[model samples]
Target chain A: MPTRNDMLLLTGFVAVVLAAPFLFEPIGAGYPDLLQKFAIFGIFAIGFNILFGLTGYLSFGHAAFLGVGSYTAVWTFKLLSMNPLPAIVLATLFGGLFAALIGFISLRRTGIYFSILTLAFAQMSYNLAYSVLTPITNGETGLQLSQGDPRVLDIAFGRDYGAVLPSSDLFGLEMTGYPGFYFCGAMLIVCFYIALRIFRSPFGMMLRAVKSNQNRMNYTGLNTRPYALTAFIISGMYAGLAGGLLAVTDPLAGAERMQWTASGEVVLMTILGGSGTLLGPVIGAAVIKYFENIFSAFNKSMLGDIFSFLPESLQSGAVSVASLFVGEGWHLTLGAMFVLIVIFLPGGLMEGIRRIGALARRKKPGGGASASTPAE
Target chain B: MASILTVQNVNKRFGGLKALDNVNLEIEAGTVHAIIGPNGAGKSTLLNCFIGRLEPDTGTVIFDGVSLLGIKPHEINQVGVSRVFQTPEVFGNLTLRDNVMIPAFAKRDGSFRINAWKGVKRETDIEAKAMAMLENVGLARKADEIAGQLSRGDKRRLELAMCLVQEPKLLLLDEPTAGMARAETNTTIDLLKKIAETGITMVVIEHDMHVVFSLADRISVLAQGTVIAEDLPERIKGNPKVQEAYLGGAHL
Candidate 1:
């Protein structure tokens, strides 16, 4: 049962998410496709936080689960039906199973050694899916629905669905544009709720204990391994669900989605937002995805327009310099942001917010800074 | 008094060095038995063996009528033997209240409870029990403080609160007062004496003779990876073997 405070927080979260498309319109990410990506990746980051943020076990291979989920969801579409419900459920289950296997092996080691093990497992999966698993994954061309796909559910319903190619749907309601974004958005809310419950749960407390001191937890009569593995599997399921959504939105599953860089992207989102806090991962995911979409869209001509007031020579120089922070060179801006956050806000954006809030409170004597605000 | 812990002819070696050799000791169910030793005399090694951290090459360790050999460290703890480390191994990142609450949870819910969906704040009984444990350790005032921010003495007290919340059958202390000022040490001694009166069995390893004599009902002097003397505190003080081990001369 949620406390009164949790209920309020959830209400505010739902309100913001519901209004996100309108609110983000001026920022150029309000389109259905990009908004859906935001919701999908937000779920991904929230799941990653369960293990990495709360438990402090950095699995460098989470992309493997994501890839597995995408593959499973796409296969379900090809083999079963165009409905995303069955596909997503299968994807989550498969992702959890794969994570359980990997976690069983990887969690035996700690710190960097465990990270390396996860990385190796993910890389192995990527290599196999890219090459040897061509029969299942369809290799470099990627996996897509075939014209002769046996969508059993459609046939059972006496509907000849694959005249061309079928888009994912929820019981004949097509998953595209506003409807798709809303579907992903609703799923993100559910994922967020589960993460919130875990954060406040005793199991979450044990995971925090594992992060704080596993050795001490052991002597305190707790087995740390099962707790860690459970967190890993839960996070893996979240990644899987994200991948399923990706396939649902696009109807294509690519091996590239399971690569190390994809895993690293979620890590960036979590740490950049703040680990170990409830809203941090979702905020981080939004910030990263929003920047990825908006920053890459700006061209040199656009930059030149923004600096048109300056002299010709000076303006060109300014455009060239500023170009490194946008468009194809957007990674430079991301890297700079990461470095700044790590140095100034070690706890991520949450700490930065807290510091700013503290400053605001100091400026106003007898401000409404309650006792509940976490002490620095 | 009935024996709560019995170690018989246990031997352990790390590469070429004998970490513990032919070690045998029995701890009474309700007495504080102190083991004093110079550096490298295997006090830590012996304690590690008891907690299943190191498997002895020979002999047996029986605690509360069950063999502790080859079991996991957590299993040892579940069997009712808990240790307080030399550096105080409380969860530094958690609050002092949570540090106690975790051990309380382990004791009540056992080693692996999957209460993942239940809110921690709803566990009022556990919170009250943890608060009571903090009060016993004189840290109820600092319950909300981050444990890592606490002073060394308070951190040690928090560790004690964590251990005591489990209500272990045997409590092992490794240099519990290793790094402390005189005043802190005195306070620790008083706290420990209060704990001793509760009838919990304890095996304390210490280099501080002041702490040892003040709390130990009996003393065992370890030298060169073996027991050199075992007797009441008064007799152990007068034993020539202990005198030679510390001073290299009987008179000194």
Candidate 2:
């Protein structure tokens, strides 16, 4: 049922995602670790948008689902098998289960109260996983696969790793480096396709109605609670898949993933890239990850090299000033960019792109009519 | 004619304020019934009780032989009742067509369904029906326009179209022409007349005597939380009690 424009968008999206390694080489983000993070967080942000952007339910505890997914994946690896497929599947299921529990409770309230309830539940979960749930989560050290643990499925399949720990895999392809990135990238595409379908569906329309006017929806004989809960569960599963992919690439699950800061990061990504648009969240994720990895790597010596063209006294002063905006201060740059984007383009980066497109079309003789259509 | 809605011995209190004091009314099928009252006559409070928004302290509200009390607003709607608020409650962020289409979907799909796999564009039948409803209200030309940007009269019309798309057994309209110019009010009266011709039972709450006389088959005049008069529109105009309670004995 996709329109021609939708088909074209999907084709272009797939092509760009598949060619990311080469396309990003010039920008110095072609490496596998950062590329994997991009795909993983992209999935996370897109899922978050389904709940936050469409329904206007800004969850500040989505990181709890992400962390739950990672722990589930790690447990699957340690107790069942090293196959990333089963690990990922279990992670998504567990994540959805957790979301259902939390959503049922938190959704009883709305507005700022709902936000606070979700935050409270997530903090409770983080504390539980960090301290009391040490038997399963490994306390402060995090949950990791051990050679001594039983691998019922792997042993049954005649796979053996005597002393060295084994990385998660899909059949014979090891999930590490480029292969790992490709695996996560493929999942990202699948997730994007599913999100796209939901966006074009009746259910998505109902979710938007919930945001528009719950009282109207109720009087129209449409139950808004179930629709909102379903979106919450679906988004939770996506966060779980992203978390499982993280374990597939790195084989580690830590409590830090559940921190409120991690939750806020996804919110920033969605808003910065434009929450409601299809491609905005993924762009936001990539930009944030790119800054986190690339800009944070900038050192004083690198700044000195770039500013060497200036006079010696001015060069030192410039490096000193610029140094506070990169490396450990990369967050400052991100914060400034967020402020600018919110001020100049309240609709996010996608709005800027749309304006440019509108401008270009307006230059054509008859294109002005279509170009003047209001943004959704 | 069979009564579609029967309210008996209904009473409500808001902490010492008697909002509804033993109110009773009956709406026959396929007739337009208007409940006219001065301000603070418990007109809206009675409407709220019928729609499950407020729980009356004591009463029975029966619609189609089923109790309307102790049900959710959506459950009440599912039982073949729909309402248009005094202030239009259309989905402001969505297009006018979408606003109508949502109620149509609710009617077809029931209270809830996960129609996530099928594209909304594939529902051609609902699309056509939504357009037809918009055309009914004379908003078809602006069907794609955002509902929020519409004028007050246009939004009320859009809300009516939204409710009509459901084809409910009984419709409840509150102040259908509350804040409209004379021209817009006449247009709405004509539109409501057209809908009344379709044989759907309606309960209208209004203060405008002109709109009331134009649309109501029978009238109930409420004053001080009690029905002071209930009769045909012509008789009610000359009823002494109605004039004394409503207009302080002013001549009609």
Candidate 3:
């Protein structure tokens, strides 16, 4: 949150971000593209947090819904028009429907086994999309638009149904880069607000109840499986929406996007930012997307040039060591981040921030929060 | 008075041992009934059966007009029957208010929903009811304290608060003062007496003869799986059959 004060800070931060392309457009960081990816992934991570963070259900197959959504959105383009809005909605629906079916079966188990089931299903989806579902998914090369795209509505309107959108537009409305950026940004805000609402709701309390002491929830006459399943479905729907947005922004859908590795990336994002904390997943999404887009852009030659003034041997070694932190080897950094977070800070980075915040609060008089309070 | 609750032909076997054999009893409404037994007399088993926590191999547990076999514990509570477990199964992670709120929530919310948009404050009059229940059991000041941090005496009071919050017609307490200190035990006995005066029918399983004598309007003494005698406290205290089952065997 940036607070009200924090929100003002964040709003200012976003304003700076929106202006970055104009400020540093000469530099090819693609500030607009970077911001778009951040907002999109932020939505995805927030959805993941609801399922994994709040409910304590570790899902390893979330990528399937994301994939399902992407494929659905692309299919809409192939069958209807390349209108991004319709594709997004249709993709979200397809993702949620797919999730409902999987959640029904997987939520019967919990802990490692539950995670394994979701992972197995996700892998199965990946394999099928890459091969067996070739007719629909277009296989390894991935699904894309063709001239035969039967977007009847677009064709009836005397337009090419399968063509790529011209940056952005609406029916007689001008939409360019900033409008598109604000579109995704507002969606992210909506997603964050919804997650915050659920966190404070009685339904959210029941989910936590299901997480902490499931048996007690059962003994209290709640059929616990239904609650877990519902949460699973909702989270799956979220993944689907994120996937739809990805396809919308890029105008392509790929099997690799739905891989187990991608699923693992989401889990990493949620935990690194802190599970069970409201803004943590969004923060995590932004951090990971930034590193992926910006950090990886630095290559061995760039590193070599930066350290050219150093001795020749030390300069080359610096490139090697820095390369180990990014590019094809970036996962090592991601993995180490998770291990350190799990061992040293099991409550995640959010708890660390909270502790610091508490310390600052203690320096003020009468600022000690009551320990026994349960949030309503 | 016609019995409002009945446990008929109840039998439970754990491998080769018969924990309860053809146990039968009838409990009248508004009476404080006590089940006194030796260590292995299946007092807890009978209590568990009555509460639908453990199914008996053979039995009919009839509460009011409904069969108690397949009903959940909270559903049973909804039907005006509730049990306090032997070890006081309080929610350790919650406060005393939250602990009481749990059973009260069960009564109020129908156990589950997807009310993700509704605020907790507007859910019901839960906070006021939970506070009043705590006040009733003398735990009002400690309502905000974590239940796990409570003293044993306070824990017992907390458990009693949980059971009573639902306003059950039949309240079952299993050894409510089992491990309490002498002072705590007496306080529990006094509390039970005060509760009984309110006309809430109770069935208690107590090993403490002093507390049992102080509370029971009628006592059923069990030896082996079946009741050896059911009488007033004075008669059960002097019965030779009870003497043989307990006094002769050096059992409490």
Q: Each prediction's TM-score against the native?
A: 0.97, 0.98, 0.87
Candidate order, lDDT descending: 2, 1, 3
Worst 10 residues of 1 chain A by lDDT: A365-374
lDDT of 3 by residue, A1-376 (tens): 2136445645654665556456445545456667777777888888888888767899999989999988988787767766677877887788889988998889889999999999999999999988878988888778776665677767788875244443223453323355555667766776776776677666776777676666555555556777787778778877888888777666678999889999998998888889888778877887777667666667788778888999998988888888887777766777787789889878777888889998888777756665435455
Give the higher-DockQ candidate: 2 or 3: 2
Worst 10 residues of 1 chain B by lDDT: B243-252
* Winner of 2 and 3 under lDDT: 2
DockQ of 3: 0.43
Off by over 4 Å in 3: A1-30, A156-178, A306-309, A365-376, B94-96, B141-156, B178-194, B208-211, B247-252
Tens digits of per-residue lDDT for model 3, B1-252: 868799899999999999899988999989999999999998988888877778999889998888888777656767777666666677765678777876777667776668687655555588789899899889998877887788888888887887787788888888889888899998888888988999988998989899899999999988788988999888887888999898666656
| Residue A133 miss distance in model 1 (angstroms) | 0.2
Kindly report which residue stretches of model 1 are placed more than 4 angstroms away from their true locations once superposed: A368-376, B14-19, B249-252
How well does candidate 2 score on lDDT at residue A146? 90
Candidate 3 residue pairs in backbone clash: A2-A6, A2-A7, A3-A6, A79-A151, A80-A151
DockQ-based CAPRI category assigned to the predicted complex of candidate 1: high
lDDT per residue as tens, model 2, A105-213: 8988888898888888888888999888999889789999898979899999999988999999889899998999999999999999999999998899999998899
User: Quick one: best DockQ, which candidate?
Assistant: 2
Which clashing pairs does model 1 show?
none
Q: What TM-score does structure 1 among the candidates reach?
A: 0.97
Fnat of all models, as shown: 0.88, 0.87, 0.45
